[model samples]
Target: MTRTRVPALGAEGWFTLDAETPALLGDRCTACGSYAFPPAGSFCRNPRCASTAFATVPLSRRGKVWSYTDAQYAPPSPYVAPQEGHVPFCIAAVELAEEGLVVLGQVVAGVTVDDLQVGTEVEVVLDTLFSDEDHDHLIWKWRPVAAGGAG
Candidate 1:
């Protein structure tokens, strides 16, 4: 499911992994042709230029696993683990083409640590981190990529 509200940091547009919207989000520097995810809220990190105006750019959904690990124990405050049962979640860092940067997120449903390895191939997937009675916090996650021959 895609998040409906506009992103708060760099991009003014909302994010989604729905078939209709299957791109990661980043801010493109109008000054330079660089992009940053989670939107570079502060300023462009590129050392070569000093520009402020940023445009929302769609990122590639598929990437190769740069590295991975799992949270053996529940994370502390701010991370609200489900109350019903403690489920260990796998998080991965994926490296995209052209960007040369690594994006980190959780593995999707039906995936586990046992299924992951460094340099594995992965694709971005949108999933809910949690939902209260009122709203759901949607986030981008990674999973084994089908085309990469992941098994």
Candidate 2:
């Protein structure tokens, strides 16, 4: 049996999976150079800038851990829980250097609180969220940067 891969949630153009290197996508205000993830549909988020034009840009693949926590309970609707019930998972907020913004996402599987710390470097990677007999949902996740460097 073969399982089809799909995005766990609705497509919002926040990231691209078809590219050779998957990357989180963002929008940059042409005027102020401010960036926003999930791609800002209109207007610059910078209060000082009046420009509404933006260009799609790929966000930094690497970042430093700003904070982290574990979810011990199942999340609310739209988030499909595992068939076995809630499983605690680590979540991390990483600060991107060039983007100058913090992005939050789930840490890759097998990573625990003991394996991370503030200032630890991490990189984005694709991982399976959950799967039914016919489909496997893929989602972006963060993993600790290896000793050799970014992977």
TM-score of each: 0.81, 0.86
lDDT of 1 by residue, 9-128 (tens): 322344554554357878888888787876785589899979988888778878888888888788986677645567888899898887767988888766787888877888776666
Query: Using TM-score as the measure, which candidate wins?
Result: 2
Instruction: Specify the poorest-scoring 10-residue window by lDDT in model 2.
Output: 142-151
| Candidate 2, backbone clash total | 0
Point out the worst 10-residue segment of candidate 1 by lDDT. Answer: 5-14
Best by lDDT: 2
Per-model clash counts, in order, read 0, 0
Residue pairs in collision within model 2: none
Name the lDDT value of residue 28 in candidate 2: 94
